[model samples]
Target: MKFKSAFYLLFFFSAFLSFDGVAQNKHTFEIKQGNFLYDGKAIQIHSGEMHYSRIPHQYWRHRMQMLKAMGLNSVATYVFWNHHEILPEQWDFEGDKNLAEYIKIAGEEGLLVVLRPGPYACAEWEFGGYPWWLQNISGMELRRDNPEFLKRTEIYINRLFKEIGHLQITNGGPVIMVQVENEFGSYVSQRKDIPLNEHRSYNAKIKDQLVRAGFNVPLFTSDGTWLFEGGAIDGVLPTANGEGNILNLKKAVDQYHGNKGPYMVAEFYPGWLAHWAEPHPAIDASNIARQTEEYLKNDISFNLYMAHGGTNWGFTSGANYDKKHDIQPDLTSYDYDAPISEAGWATPKFDSLRAVIKKYAQYDIPDIPAPFSTIEIPSIKLTRVGDVLSILEKQKSVQSTTPLTFEQLNQGYGYVLYSRKFNQPISGTLDVSGLRDYAVVYINGEKVGELNRYYNNYTMEIDVPFNSTLEILVENMGRINYGPEIVNNKKGIISPVKINNIEIEGNWEMYTLPMQEAPDLDNIKKNDVFNVPAKTKQLQGKPIIYEGVFDLSEVGDTFLDMENWGKGIVFINGINIGRYWHVGPQQTLFIPGVWLNKGSNKIVIFEQINSELKSEVKTVKTPVLNKLK
Candidate 1:
């Protein structure tokens, strides 16, 4: 008995020693003179950007392992301000939204970290990563030095710092560097011969705020290599952000410190983002491999903008400008054709990058894990629960105080309802001046008007046979992408409602439909001709709401394809899947299967446009929506 007790004691001591070794092995890194240092030793940082909310939590460790094997020493991530504190004072740190777990996993894989906690990250994200709730604030000017903007920004920064401040290298954590504001130079100094003094002033204010908020690590500003000189602040390190090439890198080194420090590429674009209606972008893997090799050969530090470009998911994707004066919003799939594909699979680019990194690594290359399995789903059907229009009638209290324009209403995230009573027969051009995007007009439950932003005009001649109540429901759809005109993105009717070239002013009831509440179909009315359905009911074969049961018995990672179905929302068990439209470009929806249950998992879909198309859900396979011919 004494011998056995001695053996158990020895085992406990051994386990303690093992844990201590692991704790010692874990390192915190710092950036000094453009080079990251691990425990006072100069180390090159090859980082990649992968948001925690974008990729599945189960895949976090796997993706980090892949990044480490590919010769990357760091994982650069953006802590989206809106993603955290999604609701007021409500914070989520589990599943895919687990930011701390992501960083901790990077550390476990023997990689450092660069945290880009953007109160405003403009990563082609919705509202430039700012919370949609801020738009509800009256006269809120984002990215400016306004008190309201600063107050919210301060709260976000303070809260985020509280969560991850001690995680920085200075505090014995893995975070090496923190970026102040992303690509500010490009936005502020886009025009020729424009002095960047204002831009610098704003940056200084941001830097001061961050420092005061407890981000003491080395702060860097990233801009395109050629444009670095214009946006560079004196004390802060200026890093190049774009495709990693020799000439541009050399130029960045010169512009940053004049040959006094190491060179770094903050945003090495492995692949470009795609906008709707634009051809899907495909970057050559061979070119990326060659550029990565060149950077490694020169001992330059670079971070792939998106090592694993996951899904924009929900209404979080942003828009961009095209050549035809069209404002193109980004698709749901953020598959930027990156080294690690959206599904977290290692592509040919991944292998090539691994080879290049292995050639220069002082340590042995780790084993590349096998790709995750794919499961194909059979076709199924979906049903409509009830109409959305009738529900609006129940909430007659949704009307706001005082007749408010779209700007005054300050409802920027979802749909808006504008209703007014027309007392007499009217015949003239009914004009909705400054309609932000799309609007549907109805008179006494008859669909009489439709206005779109394609032509930048929202005018239609209407014949009101008698006194009737005119209701116009306008959807924000999304804001404009290109040109200086993007700043004036006001939803609903921006100007005024007019008839016969005269402004129609009366008791105009404006309903703010931010869609923050769960949709209810029972509240809908058949007389309500405008609203769509809320829930689906059908359950059978083709076009049937496919109800499948699976045992997640173990939590893992996977993606969901949303391209095959029409416009509708998805739900896990009972949670809303957000909205998915088969409208060109965005073909797949991301399902971080990690959020699923071990047994009896449920998926409910509500397809708005197509009732006959078959829909399926798979565990392993990623869905790709075919373009409508």
Candidate 2:
């Protein structure tokens, strides 16, 4: 028995040598005879999913190290389209947006790559990873056979390949496979209006786009096991997602690929995503351990959906819809209850999975790296600088006969203000039909009530006087990232406004407040005049921007406790950290150490409703993920 164990260890060590040595030179990675062949030798790929855009650039190496330590040989990542191309003809690939640098760093850390460059990645990303500008293009029908959408997609694919094309396996880089499109099979089932041939043709065009862009790696498609008939690309490997039944997965792949081998689970869930106002989702550590062991025992390659889910930071988080929750926007933290916490600390799930790998993995596992340090900050004083209503009036506005959607106005994300004056006194049902998300109705700058789309609330009773201005401040919480409704996710008002069932059209002023960059508090004039009439009510129901400064002797990652504050977004040193609501489930926003300075640092908040008028924020060493309203 001892001799047999020694021989097995020697055999794996020699196989590792051959794999590592060939990676430096040109290598052949293919599927043949029921196995994944690397230089004509069978190998199992142990990969984990992590997005480069979601994590800070400075900590990429550290996160990759964590994956390696967990016994993962390969790292998979989705290249978000909107993250790279903010606007049409305006592409950003430097600094944190650098893809080539990220891939090179992964290779340096001794991990192979499986790239998922999605023109439409439904990873709870804004607009399903489609650039907002695409909605403005004439004749644009996304994720379809529309020429306009395909033309723009082709342009983006070509430009992206120019940046990381040489990193493919054929070019002596670590990249092994490239995914064609993300879960098109599920979309096909949802959108039955489009013929199956069109869906297949659209997918084929996307695959062609990737190949034309110079990706010579093995191309593949991923879908749920039952939908392989709709999602599988001809002559391309089909992989399963969220499948635990290895037998079912193998049968599905075999049925689609004519009984070939080299089966893989593209997205195996170790943990699930959490949303605001919902219980934080968690998978038992022991259950995950059993699953990991099952995969190893079956010789099946699988990638953990999110080995380390990071923050969604800024306005990039997306929304989902179902019969249960009307429109559930994802929480700011993409923690996903993953094996690695949002702050880069390993959880019990990590330990259990690592133990399984140590016992069954053919290759040797690396030691877990030291965890990152965190610090707590004392409460810092904040003061109201200016209210959003007053500041918004100063910006330019367009006069329209009817309220315009964010896409129609050519504004991507953020808040939009719609204003109109009533000539005659009117009181009754004040309803806004086709409201994209949330809106605060105001009469002469005083808050009357609010309509939240998440709850399907769009009507309210109101009493108005003659010659009073009626304003509706609408916020684009996030666009739908999944399901058939994503095609109609136009922000702001999509329909018309009505009073007592009478349409209020014409002479409307619409202001596009994208909030792409945080306001420069030092330059903006401060306002001492209060908007609320009550003496105790300071900026009640008013959108106010508060500014504060704190000094940090040493820099370390921390969580800003926004439990006391109401719904708003926080910015540190002019960088938009993320959004926080009093609704619960997510009571803190992560502050990366890299974003902090050693000396004085500035913080800003765009508070939409401050009933308590709280003017301070504290940083804690630990996160509060389960706090509820």
Taken over the whole model, the C-alpha lDDT of each candidate is 0.64, 0.84
- Runs of candidate 2 with Cα error greater than 4 angstroms are 1-24, 526-538
Q: For every model shown, what is its TM-score relative to the native structure?
A: 0.82, 0.95
Worst 10 residues of 1 by lDDT: 13-22
lDDT of 2 by residue, 333-365 (tens): 999989999988889999988898888654567
lDDT of 2: 0.84
User: Candidate 2: worst 10 consecutive residues by lDDT?
Assistant: 13-22
Candidate number with greatest TM-score = 2
Pairs of residues clashing in candidate 2: none
**Model 1: per-residue Cα lDDT at residue 90:** 71
**For candidate 1, lDDT tens digit of each residue in 107-210?**
66666678887666777776667665666676776665567777777888888887777667565566778988777667665543334665566667777788
